[model samples]
Each structure stands twice: as C-alpha cells, then as structure tokens.
Target: MLNNVAAVLLDGVHPFELGVVCEVFGLDRGDEGLPVYDFAVASAEGPTLGTHAGFTVSTPYGLDRLEAADLVVVPAGSTFATRDYPPELLASLRRVVDRGARVLSVCSGVFVLGAAGLLDGRRCAVHWQHADELARQYPRAVVEPDVLYVDADPVITSAGTAAGIDACLHIVRKEQGPEVANSIARRMVVPPHRDGGQAQYIERPLPRSRCDTVGEVLVWMERHLDEEVTVEQLAARAHMSPRTFARRFQQETGTTPYRWLLRQRVLLAQRLLEATDETMEVIADRAGFGNAAALRHQFVRSVGTTPQGYRRTFRGSQAA
Candidate 1:
C-alpha cells in the first residue's frame, strides 16, 4: 500500500534534504525490478521556489497532490527553525495522517510536523544541533536527539542530512522487505543499515596542553592504550593524590579517567578496523580489549556494531 509519495517543499528548501526524499521514492528503478513509487514534489509556496543552495526547483503539483499520497515527506528549509509553515500545508499533513497515511520529516522539517500538531505526543528524532529548539517549540513532542531516526509509527523523523537515508531505508525495509531496502541502498552506494546512533558520531575533544593539567596524562593515555595503568600510578606520575588527580582529570576531560581510557581504546580500535587488515584478536589486543569477544562486546556497545562489521563498512570485506 506504500506506493504514492510526495516531497513537500517550502520557499527555502534545502536541496540535499529534498534530494534524499526524491532519491528514496522518486527514482524509477524498474530496470532492477524495484518498486517504483508514484512520486512527485509538491510546493507549498508556489510552482517555482528558491533553494537554500541558491537554485530554483519547480513542481506542477501542490497541496492537492498531498491528499492522495500514501507517504508524505517534508524536507528541511533554510529558515524552517524560525519561519512559519503554511496553514493549508499543515492542514493537508493532518488530513493525510487522518486518512491513515504516513508522514516523514528530515532535519528541521520536524518543525512543520510540529506546526501540524502531528508530533504532539509522538517520539521525534531530530539533529542534535536543533534538538533544544525543537523541544522548546514543541514541548509535547518527545525529542530523541541521540538516535538517527525514530519510527513513531505513522510519523517518522530523522536526524541531520545523511540520517534521512537511514529513515527512508527503514521505511522501505518495513514495507517491502530487507532485500528491497538493501538493494536500493546498494544502488545509492550507502549502507542498507547503520549500526549505531548519532552518539558514536559525536566529536570527543581531548584536553590540550597548558601549563599544568591532565594534558600530559592524556597524551600518555593515548600512547599507552595497549597497556594497563592504574589511577594511582597516573596520580603518582602527576605528583598529586589519587582523589585530586581523578577530580582534575574529570574537570579537564569532561569524563572520568576510566571512561576516557575506554573511549580512547574504542577509538583506536575503530581506526585499526578502518585502516588495517589485522584480525580481530590482534586488533583487540593492541587496543587493550584483550580478546575478540571482549572487543566485540565493547565495540558493539560503543559503535553499535561489531569490529568486523565496522571494518567491513570502512574497508570492504575483501582486501585490496
């Protein structure tokens, strides 16, 4: 029943967000025996619209086209965070859901759905950068900033730019099957399914050198991830008591010494997985995980996938 689709655009639509929707539903992949959707872009503003990228996109379809859509997509716009959505467009969204259809929003497009009141009590996934504002604007919506996407049943929301691919593929996987979704993902040269949430992608800035701090200890920790070192030993090296060293470490790095070390180990393991052809056991030992089983456990917990899976993703299964 998931056939017809429409990507609704506003005045300042971001082309990449619009492209993600079009790539998922608008392409005619009949040559590969894929299900082709009755897809088109509909403009809320007018027939012609300017893109955030300083380009123009035209669509003959309008809000009327959304009425018949089995799935409706709202792509983020330049001022979606502050701009007002057209009331008619919001009404059409509500009507589409009322008629038992599904709706999806990429990035700030969730704001449009919020305006429609569709996300009133629903769990929503939004980019971390906008999560605060989204929560502020739609206090009733449960904003999950860490996740890549959330399938709040009829309403799907995704985080950031590429996460839209994750949401689209998830819907395809749900409706058609894993094979269809995977095939489409392969054609797009993206993963059919990503392992972890956005937490794995967030930047972890390490403390840098200054006159006196945990900078040298951090440098030592980074160099000696393969070795086992105690907080007492680190404290002794820093010429401070264990309690003071622990506090200073936490203050400077924004995390406990144990957590910082574990994260560093995981990071090293990731780099080794991506660039080296070492076996899991070897990589684990080098990264201080001790064994493959431990590596797999910690890797999955930290990266949302096994070391082998992560390696396969970053460096294809077959060696070059």
Candidate 2:
C-alpha cells in the first residue's frame, strides 16, 4: 500500500538520519522481489539543502513530489526546536496528510510535523533531548518518552537516530508483510526487529560527583531487575540521605530513579519475551513483575501492545 514514498530533507539535516530513510526505503533491490519504492529526496523550496556538516545536497524534485507519495518521511533536522519551518512546506505537508496518506517522522522531524499541525491530537515520540521542547511546543500532543517510537494510527513518529530504522521497518511490516521487512533488515545487516523500546537507553539519576559509583549502581540495578530496589538501598551506595539524594538525582538526570529502574525491568521482560521460549509467568518473575497479569498491564501501558502479541508479530521470522 505504501510503495511510493518521499523523504523531505530540510536545511541543517543530519546526514545519518537522512541516510536512514534512504537505507530503509530508497534502496533498489529488484532481485529480491521487494517492493521497490518510488523514493526521492526533495527540498522545501527546490534549492540545495544544507546539512549539519555544512554540506549542500541537491535534489531533483521539490515539494510537489510529496503530494503524490503514499508515505512521506520527515527525517531528522538539526535545531528543529529553534529553527523556522517554511509556511509553504508546512502547508504542503498538511495537504498530503489531509488526503489520507501516512506521514512518518524520524527524530526531531516530529517538531516539523508538530509545526505543521499534524501532531496536534496524536501521540508522538522524539529524541530524548528534545522531548521536553516538543511537549512545550505542542501541549495537546500526547508525548511518549518511554518508547523508541510511537505509532499513532497512520502518523508514526520515532525517537532519535537509529530508531528511524525501526520506525521505517515497522511501516514496511505493516504495509507489505513481516517477510518483506525481514528481508530488508537482513540486507541491511541489523536485527530484523528490535526487541524493546527506548527504556533501556534512558539515563538514570545519581546524586554523587563520582562517576564510577553511578555506573556500579546502575549495573547492580540492571542485574537484579527481578527484585525490588528501594531508594534507600541505592542511597546507601551513594552514601546520601534519601531526601537530598532524590533532589540531586533529579538534577543529574531528567527522570526519577524509581521510574528509570522500572522501565529497565520492563525492557528486560521484553527481551525474554521476544528472544526466548519461556512462559509469560517465568518471564514476568525474571523481570521483577510477580505475575503474568502484572507484566501484561505494564507492557501494554508502556508499549501499546501485549507481550505475547508483540513477540508473535516481531519474533524471529528471519530465522525461518
């Protein structure tokens, strides 16, 4: 359904994020019988676009190609939170979206989509650094910070950098089939699917000035995800009172210590579910959730999908 795709390249675009869109959708592997895309990179005003590295990229097509695309990709651009988006490009993006085609955004591109008003009522995901800015700009958008990507019906948004691959693969899986997506991923030499969301990569809070202490504490938490870790225990490692620790910890990291620990535990559960043949109850226990029901509740709350269902849908069909 989405064989025709377009990637909108804005000025100050990061090369790798633009390359991710090209890697996933612009490759022509005709021998594999994959659905080759009608892919082209277009500028906002038919001019040579500048990248973050101070280089210019010339494009053949302009904003008009986006109107004909079944799927439009907005790749990451630098300083999107600080930059001004062209009104004409914004209008063209809105017009295509109004016609019912899907719009996919990578990293800070969510800011551009938000500027265009397409992300008004939708749930969105962005680079962790820009999450607060996006929330500030579009208070109406349900901002998801726990996941690498958020698929809100037709408009899909991904967090920074490598998450763009996952987002694009999700689109391929949804439009064509799991089989085709797996093929593309294999050709790309990455995992056919990533197991968890952005939980594992989230930075934790530590009050201490010593960097090694924080690392030791985090290692302990990750290894013992199956057990309850009170703030007091973590505080003992840092040798600080609970009250002072909580306050300073918040300053060191953007999130609370408890929330960071809980998300990692959930991601651990995700790995076992996706890669192992273990039962849900056993996986739940290993992930610190006492029962399958608890695991299901948390998994759905954070990931928008069930454990068994996610595994079945993205489990290693490439192995087959």
Candidate 3:
C-alpha cells in the first residue's frame, strides 16, 4: 500500500539525509521482486536548491508532487532547526497526514514537522544534539533524545544520518514485510535490523584524568560479557572503592555499570541471534542472561522485540 514516496527538500538540505531517503525509497528494486516506489524529489523553496555541501540540486517536482505520495519525507538540512519552512509546504504536510498518508522526518527535518504542528503531543526522535532544542521549540512534543527513531504513526521521526535508513527500512518492514525490508537492506549492505538506541553513539565527555582506568575495565568487560561480575568485583579490578568506581563509571560512560553491562549483553545476544542458529538457552548463557526467560525479558526491554522474533526477522531477511 505504501507505493508512492516523495522527498521534499529545502535549501541547505544535508545531502546525506536526502540521499538516505532517495536510496531507500527512490530506487527501482523491482528486479529483485521488491516493491518499487514511485518516487520523486520535491523542492519546497524552489526548483533549484543549494545544499550545505556547496552543490545545487534541481528537481522537476515541487510541493505539488507531494499530493500523490503515500509517504512524504523531509530530509535534514543544515539550518532546519532554526529555518522557517514555506507555509504551503507545511500545509501540504498537514493535509497529507489528514488524508491518512504518512510523513517522516530525518534528524533536523523534525523541526520542520514541529513547524507544521505535526509534533504536538507526539513522541519524536531527533539527533541528540537537537533533542533539547526541539523540545524547547515545540513544548507540546515529547522529545526522546537517545533513540534511533520514533514511530508515532503517520509521523515517524529519526535521529541522525544512518538512523534515517533504519526508519525507512522500518516503514518498509511494517508495510511490506521483513522479506522486502531485508532484501533492500542486503542490497544496501547494511543490517536488516540494529539493536539498541542512540545512547551508545552519544559522545560522553570523560573527566580529564591522568589515566583512563574505566576504559581498561570496559575492554575487559567487552571480552567477558558471559562472565558474571559484580560492581564490587569490577571496582576491585579497577583498584578503587565500589562507590568511587561507580561514580567514575557514570562520569565516563554516562550510565551506571549495570546498565552498561545490560546493554552490552543485549548487543551480544542480538549478534548471536542474527548470526548463529543456537538454542535460546545457549544464547542466554553466552550473553550472560543465564536463561532464556531472562534473555527474553532483557531483550524485550532493550530491543523492543523478543529473541525469537528477532531471530526470525533476521534469518528471514538472510534467507531472502
């Protein structure tokens, strides 16, 4: 049902974000039995728009092209966070959603959605750098700062660059099937699905210290994900008191030790689920979850999907 797609652009649009939308929805993948969208690039400012990369893009399509789209994408721009959108473009977006079509924003493009009044009372995801500003600008919108994407139906929002790919594939997976989304991902040479959120990508400013004591512990922790180690034990390994170690870990990593361990374990489980045909119990033990039930609980909490479901989706795509 999601056949027609259009990317509406403004001046100073980030080429990568525009390319993300184009790559996902503009290509004719029907050769591989994948759905082919009737795609176009629409210019909100004019027929010719300059990108932040010091190049110009000319499109035959304009805002009028959006009327036929089942999905309209607003790709990120350099000044989108502060720029004013054309009233006509914003009105078109509102009408598109009003008529049951979906609209999606990649990174800073979300600010445009906020301008269109589409984000009111909806949970949205944006690049972490823009999350606070977006929340301040659109006080009614719930800004999730650390997620890859948020699907508030009809108005999906994604975090920076690569997150747009995830959101686009998610839309494909939701509308078409895992097979189609996976096939597209295979062609793209990206993962069909990624575990976890943007928290890991955020740059935490560690304290200016003479030694990176926590970094050493992180390396050890990564290597021994299957090992059960208490914070007290890890603190001992770091040659610091448990309280000091905990504080240092939080300061350096922006998360507590338990959360960091849990996230790492979940990531390990995801990789295992995708790559190995191991039983749930085996994976649970290997990922330090101890049992399938624990793995399922933590996996569901972190990845938002059951291990079995994740495996099925992953393997299904690989099979395709």
Top-lDDT structure, candidate number: 3
Tens digits of per-residue lDDT for model 3 on 7-114?
Answer: 999999999999999999988888878888899999998889999999999999998999999999999998888878899999999999999999999999999999
lDDT over C-alpha atoms for residue 113 of model 3 = 96
Q: lDDT for each of the candidates?
A: 0.85, 0.81, 0.87
Q: Which stretches of candidate 1 lie over 4 Å from their true place?
A: 195-320
How would the candidate models be sorted by TM-score, starting from the highest? 3, 2, 1
Give per-residue CA lDDT, model 1, range 167-198, as digits (tens).
99988866765567878999999866652243
Q: What tens digits encode model 2's per-residue C-alpha lDDT throughout 244-266?
A: 66655555544578877777777
TM-score of each: 0.64, 0.65, 0.68
Best by TM-score: 3
Query: If the candidates were sorted by their lDDT against the true structure, best first, what order would they fall in?
Result: 3, 1, 2
| Model 2 alpha-carbon drift over 4 Å, by segment | 195-320
After superposition on all C-alphas, the RMSD of every candidate to the true structure, in Å, is: 9.5, 6.9, 5.9
